[model samples]
Target: MDVVKYLQRAGYTTVQKSFYAKIAEWESWYIGNVRKFHRYRIYNGKSYVSCRRLGMGMAKKLSEDIADLLLNEKVQITIQDSSTHEFVTQVLNDNNFWVMGNDYQERKAYTGTVAYIPYLDAVRVSENGEIVDGGTVRINYVSAEDIYPLSWSNGYISECAFVFYKTVETKLYAQIQIHKLQNDQYVIENHVVECTNGAGREVPSEKWKDLKDFSGLSEWVETGASERQFVVDRLNIVNNYSKDNPMGIAIFANSIDILQGLDTIYDSYINEFVLGKKRIFVAPELLYTDPLGNPAFDPNDVTFYQLPEDTLKDGGKPITEIDMNLRADAHEKGINDNLNFLSVKCGFGQNHYRFDNGSVQTATQIISENSDMFRALKKHEIVLQSVLEELIRIIARLGQKMNIPTDPDSKMVIDFDDSIIEDKQAERSTDRTDMSMGILRHEEYRAKWYGETLEEARKNLPEQNQVIE
Candidate 1:
């Protein structure tokens, strides 16, 4: 296949690269390599103050908060069919799906992820006692940069291209899964994909065609969507981050640049403050000045200045110490302003983070109905609920493919513990009051308390009614 032409037809190379760049920046910030991403400027003949400053870690912290708030505790998932429920439960346990969800959540927070079913071999014995092929179900997670949405309508992706690399024969080979419509039906066509090397040649290994698995019948099932076995998780999308793009921005994308700027300014202030505080001018006669005529002293040594009797004639000491305290106040104020701006822009709300006494501190957690942070968490919770629901459907589809009779329409209940956002006991007290007053049904009250959906709570409602009657 013409890899270049195919990529051109898909027209996501630019978008993919752009997303890759953002991922790179987010990754750098996550791991504390932020200085290079937002380098500090040097001016006024001042050498670049190469001070190692602590990174903001805003992306890392925010992503971690998302995972912890959404999936740190047990995620309540309910399926109707007993057999399918057990099967999916085992699959999730074996795959550590909840733990994997944390990693996936981090990915979604950064650049989004694609969940797809990959074909695998399931072992079966033939009647003649020979081992034979049985289709296996496996869910594979791919990153946004690797999975490109080729076509879309009404904000839904119709076609996609998943490009990845495999090492075969000690050489890197490009592999692509093009999930597109064939004969007016969705089909996944595997290709030995290649891209232009430095020489601009469509270079593919001789083993590329041999590696293609063309034997099995295509796994085809209508998902009521254009794609057969893939779902895109777009979290916190931003516009104009790049040219007309399909990829969603990271959760903290809006504030990363600001955070970067803040990091630089904070570091610069620190370096300047440290230098000023340590600045000791020893009667220019005791120290040497550099070409810039700035007093230079050996930082590694303690210098002693000898004072002549004449120097103290007017009670003026030979040593002059400059107190930069007032100047540092301005820097401190600027740093505080930026930190508050970052906190608010990143959805943590104003004063969530505070700069105090040369260190940063987070404001105490407030569990109040009127709290902005609680509202922010609720907004994100809504999006997270939808994402988890979609993921459960994908897993259920995999279960069906594995011959575990799963009802695709089976309801899934995702109970996120809102205790972190508000006072759970107080809320429960209010719920109990409402229940006693007949303002809320017993099933609804129980569902809220037990973290169950109304339908799941109804299974036990009959017994309670019988006892009460």
Candidate 2:
């Protein structure tokens, strides 16, 4: 989709479309639809070439694994206010944020950036035309290719536009939502243009008549709040693609060559089995013939082939079995070596992935706190933590607008899943020992292990007499 052109037509200026086009390239690799290569082979003394797709699919796996590591069901987001926390939890559950949120993370990992936009749904109005309720907050997850920065400074995107598509029957339309700062307040503009080609290309000015004035939505909305209603999340990496670019590059963007190498090695390993199967060559006289004189062998036996009649006369064996050597060991080693290189390049420590016995296995060993994977996870969580906090704040603000008695200023705490990197059991044992040695306080231990605030842990501590029991 030519999102930039269409957005411009909607009166919203944005970054060049080529930036998003680059994101599309990363998306292709993430889905394993990389550039096709020609495979040449010789059959019947004639050379043939065929286009083949790389079947490793490691790029998708890398994104999925990193996303899972960053955000999973085990991760928790806490809001201090009971009412606001309950409301946000209910909203997240309603939206299946646990599942879809991880998917969004995967998209963010591969596409470099993603946005979470909170919009009200099923709004209610009073007799005086005042909003009685701001309605439920629904989230729209936009990936990199659809995100256009309208205004940004110092690597921060202050105003942006998100492009979405809706298809009515067979006709497609582009829904451009622009979030811009007007008079220090965020204003949202919505425009819908008919995509005559169904590809979101720029529609000619003469064809503006086909544009929808409004997509069953308000033409523009003054959010009444200074803060944005959307949260942008991205991997913690420098945008080497463009130093001034506000967007981030994919986690594996710097390691595309390694990814291609991994796929190439894996493809070769797979093909080895197909091309190295044993074969039996039988002399022509030893082969049976059907009624029509067609050479015949056991129908179920595909490994045998009839050889030329002059084979035996030329001092060749009448029947012979050719067992070609399969370099399974060598191929496995090559794949594993490349996987290690890829793992290190993508921020997972070396040996994080292993290809053994035709199966891929993730390293299950506990990672030290100082390990690269741990540091990378923490770096990523820095951005995600703020994103989740902002999303909660948006939900709270929307609830307040609806007169839902929400505290938008409530403090939020995000606890990311670290079980994959930390050895929880061992850490708990160490903490226990520290507590016994007077190096750690009991309340601190409880606060850490019970996922409670220090005040809560101190208040909930048992009395001295009760501890005797």
Candidate 3:
């Protein structure tokens, strides 16, 4: 089969197109220089045309700033049961979920949508013809367009397909997984196709594999897994701005106009510096004449022009150098204004970014707690917290299905560390003052100050009292 035919038979053409569009948006922001800068043609009444442009990568800068601010560090994951905690911790460490979660959040910021797929690896049947643990649970992430939910209801995906590409020995292959409900069973169909030059041939493989169905599972009844193996993360949605679908908006989408204006102004400034304000002017009489008696000068000629006093008497002016900083101040102001607009539009608040003295610096003098910047951070954190909790639940359900000794009903807690930007010592002092006034407990103080949980803080309470004594 041809690759085109494979795609046609694969179905969900509209979904694939939407996914590519979302990918293009992400690439435009992350890869940089996707949006070409406009070059201005400078005509100084001369035959020479000077083309100049200054392309500042605003999309890349804004997206990276927000990603770093939101997910620079690993999030804290806590489980309720001690045994379940150990199992969950081991599973997360084995799968590197901390790093994956950080990347997922960042991808959400850039692509506006992302997903977590929890799947069993190396599954096999036992000698008794029963499903048993054969491998560790694994979790992977996918961007928005690559995942297509066939049906959605009450915030749950009933059926879906995930399309991805793989390379084996320089040959490209398309791997499609369709997860659906069949006979009250959770079935997944894996299809592999060799794609070359818009043609595809389906690679032969086993058809359908059944996962543990929740209808008869005790873990599903106790825990709220819903037998889901996939979770879709939609971020920064403003009217589903991309298409009629749930394609989310990019973080820096609103700042594009300001960025373009900045680029235009910067390009004009460079051109003015090179051709408009700074130039070499020489008297036409001082230049050598051509065969047609036309006044001409060789730009490459190193010969010096000998201007005599008699030339001045004949109304000839000597060679003069012209240099002026035209619109230099305006250009600086315009660039800074655009940077501020871009920062605020991306939820960094005003004055969060500043370009001064030929360098960029974030404002360090102001307290962000009372500003809109902190509010924006909190808003993003709320979404991230929920996403992480759902991801943990999916992982716990996988453990349960594997028959691993784990607590399926264990809840996860996410602790975000925002003290890097704010004055954490000041917060600690306030907590201390509250504790001294009998409004706060020593355990609560330890949890807030040392980034420990209430359990961990309680364990340290006796040691703290002994040290104080």
Candidate 4:
């Protein structure tokens, strides 16, 4: 769908549409539909060619790996207020935030940008436009192609439009939700239009009944909150494609050539077995037809071929075997080399991945803090941390608007998983040694190891003079 056309038709400003074309290209690569070249072959002095669309599916693999490293079930997000934390957790669980959040990270890794928009669902507004009762906050995940930056500053998108496509009875429609700032308050505008022939035209709201009843939605909403209700998350890479572009570029955007090379090598490796199969040339006189006109030999056996009459005129043998040498080792080495290059170019460092047994395997050894992979993970966490914190705050605000007991200003603590980069058992051993030597306090060690506050650890400590070893 031409989302930009719909955004423009809805009177919303948008970034250059050309950038989304690049997003589509990246999406194609992620899905392994890239067509780099074609293959031609000569059989029986006749030349034939066909398009070759092969890939290693490395784009998606890299993105998924990044997502797993960045945000997993082990990662903890806690709010200072216990009740607030429980409420928020329930809300996130109801929406499957952890799973969908990882998916958002993966999409952001490949498409360069993803958004989280929180809205109040099933709410009632009083005559004074105040939310009276019965509303729940819900999140809408948006990828780059559907995200339209209306206004941004210094890479922060303050005003934006998100396009959502819906199909009803084979007819397509676009709903453009625009978040803009007016009178220091964030105002949301909704537009539903018909998407036809690459253009968008106005449509009546009654055409889509769910638009109003689904979320207590309206054509215009004036949220009393000052902050934008949406959060845009992207990789930490500087966008070199367009200096003025706020959208992020894919993590492997600069390594597309390496990806293509890897796919080419892998494709060649797979074809080696097909082209190097054993073949037998048989003289036509030796292979007679049956009474029913069927060949004496199994016709399904493609390895056997009839030799030309001229070939047998020089006293050639009745049957000759031809076996082409397979370059399996050479092809494997080429593919491994390309995979190493791809790993490094995508910031995973050298030897992070290996191609083995027709599959890609990631190294499982713990990475040191000084390694490139460690640094890259930390760098990405910077942006992700902010994105998640902002999303939480927005959720809290929406919860407050719904009269749910929540503290929008509560302190949020996000503990990302670092077990892959740090040796937890060794660290714990060292801490134990330090505590025995009086270098580290017992409460401090307990708090650090057990994921607790200092006061809580101190309160739960054993008697000072009692050694219960």
Candidate 5:
């Protein structure tokens, strides 16, 4: 199908004309530069000018223009091999090009939340060979923190965050900075603690002051993990921290995993509570028999049984250490992703994965067959939820302290090392994985609005908030 004709059916006229004009110029420019028989598109029996007569600059410029026009909003190009199910979608924007839908599935649906920001200046690929018009590129920020307690509780429960973490890029400025290096469960053995030795006077930022020896030294552990990172960075560099210990004040540097892990726990808790089967919705006759044959017997369903109120358990050590350790390992997949990027910047890092099969599987098996194990699991879950809440609170405080006075609406530019910027820009770009942006945005709004409304409602209801006084 003619690209313009196909796009014309989809709509847009001026956009099509612009592309045709550019395509003609490209054919002519190529003929003049390459001194070859210029093959041109036959439209109304017209021979387009050959580009062989034109200079190399004109040909090269035309080539760029042709590439740009391919992505112009007017040309909705769909490229697919007769042999393959994959098709790539590219859309040209005012200043960038975006390609998406290079996944297992041949088709991809974009609701709007999906922004295909290129990793700076790299080309995006598609299952189909053609580039869609008005393709916008995406930019990915290498982050240090995307999860919490990388070595410990890698999840959160019963939590609601009113923050804009979803669309907000994980770049340094866009990210929530934890500069204070607060202590979490995983302790770093070597850390740098500071204290003014002379007069306990606070030092101002702009002024240069005479410094004596410092106090408040703390121990933090700096493992040479980054030295063993897997891949290379855009700078053609690898993580190379060979030191057995990096300087630090805490046992471990508060990592991105802590925040991300907290979110997981919160989400998991909410899922078990809110996504359970509804007794009222279940038909009385079919409730006893379902086709999937795996309807969870939810205790919360009043119609199912006269379920007793959940009782609090006595404080005891977590018995599911093996399971917990495995869970932490399994959750580190994303954590390791950011770590890999960081390793390229600072040095290499020893990667860890959240183990999913062994202990977690065993615990699930035991809890499924034995009621006692189930109760213990429930108790552990409750404790885990409580612990996660405390962690969030601590992080929140650290976040507050870390917040520096800066414009919330500031446009920040990340400067890469000029030596490697060219190569980095040439690397392959990644497409945003999120597609159902509308639903996710809606969910985000609902969560935000729901939390605010609930908070306001509670403020007005002394009966609910009386404990505050």
Candidate 6:
């Protein structure tokens, strides 16, 4: 067995440094200063080392035997290719170091760089670093809730995300389940959380604010769509100014059949802030309508299909077009009407029309349809902000028209041209409204009186005077 050539085959550049380390009795500098592998301590020691002997046959069994002896002998050896480190480590795992096999793994090696020759020996790194391998749990899915320390924003339902990114193909279905505590009986609740705030953020006005087992747990398969995608904590939506709230979230798997069944689902507590409540698990799609419609895309007319096409489809009915359109149109109309109302209330540079009561009657008229009006600017802040810009524009126009003083910090409101209104009564869409002020201000505008005013207004008429007699 040529140690020098073996090192060369292992791709070790410094042949003497690698080979001499093997035969040295004690940890000697020539052999003691072996090399570095990320997790394992590297040193060279002589073995009945295999060079190019078993010719073309890489016996995994021989590597296993060598690994056992190294562990018993407590000698360190370096293999050239790190690619086979897993195989060698498996032998070590089988012989000794029977703690958890997959975690805090000392198997970190560059794919093409160093490899484990036979097996190397080293003591467990630390009391804290010592892992009770707990043998191995062929975990179909691991819920991080029990182990990982989780923190999430309060007030909103949070989702617990579970990311399973493995090479082997597996199909596993996972859903979060919550049991509400009531009358000492735990009732299972499903589809409790809502994806409010348009996107999947804060909770809606649906759930109690202080429910226990608050959802902030997110669960899902590791699709690699959005990075930082891992299933570490529970999820829920909270207000913009919420503090951290803790709760329990449970994970359930469909079946344990697949070779790589990493249960993947994004989940949340419907309402965590509610006190004395059972945990509620929910599937997002269960309570959802596809943003546009169809759950999965159809090759035919897949306009509103689900993205990626891999997600299992769930369907519930949506409202009729009439209902949906009615609501949406109502919202749109509400915005426009509110603006109109604001314009009239602010006088729009017109002499404010007042009833005998001295209160503007038009203001009342503006709000008459408030019930049906969409609150485009309903929230105090939202409305004020929207009107601020339009208000400035209106003030500028009014100053030009009536020489009116514009309030600097006002929500600008101005009158609409008459012709722009509906014609139910007299069709006011013309430049002159049903009011007389706009007409009076026009230079070429003529006034037509109804009865006596016509004669009076025309009294200066030179030609028509004889007809009046």
In the range 60-84, model 3's lDDT, one tens digit per residue, is 6666666666665645666756776
Question: RMSD of each candidate?
Answer: 7.0, 4.3, 7.5, 3.8, 35.0, 38.9
Cα lDDT tens digits, model 6, 355-419, are 22211233224321442221211221232233223323322322222223323233222221111
What does candidate 5's lDDT look like per residue over 1-469, in tens digits? 1323322343422122333343343333333422233222323566655321112122222223222322223322211221111111211222233332111000100000111112112222232311212222332222111111111112211111010132212211111111112222222221111222312222332221222211211222221121111110111111122111111111011222332343344334334444453433332333343577755555455544322222113332222112121233433444344433322222112221122331111111211333332333243234323322332222222222223222212211111111111222222111112213433233233222233232333344446323253
- Model 3 stretches astray by more than 4 angstroms: 1-23, 35-53, 97-100, 125-131, 154-158, 182-185, 206-225, 242-244, 276-318, 366-370, 401-403, 447-460, 463-469
Better of 1 and 2 by lDDT: 2
Query: In TM-score terms, which candidate is top?
Result: 4
Give the per-residue lDDT of model 2 (tens digit) for 46-114: 665454744677778989998998889998776667799899999899888999999999999899999
Q: Clash number for model 3?
A: 5
Model 1 agreement with the true structure over 131-195: per-residue lDDT tens digits: 24446555666766576677765556667777666554544555677677655656665555443
Better of 2 and 6 by lDDT: 2
Q: Which residue window of length 10 is worst by lDDT in model 4?
A: 35-44
What's the CA error at residue 319 for candidate 5, in Å?
58
lDDT of 5 at 29: 34
In model 2, which runs have C-alpha deviations exceeding 4 angstroms? 9-13, 38-48, 124-132, 198-215, 289-297, 309-316, 432-443, 462-469
Model 1 CA deviation exceeding 4 Å by range: 1-6, 9-37, 40-55, 112-136, 166-170, 183-185, 193-227, 242-244, 277-329, 367-371, 462-469
What local distance difference test score does each model get? 0.62, 0.81, 0.64, 0.83, 0.24, 0.24
Instruction: Give candidate 2's error at residue 447 in angstroms.
Output: 3.5
List runs of model 4 lying over 4 Å from the truth: 6-12, 35-48, 126-130, 197-199, 206-216, 289-299, 309-311, 435-447, 453-469
lDDT of 3: 0.64
TM-score of 5: 0.14
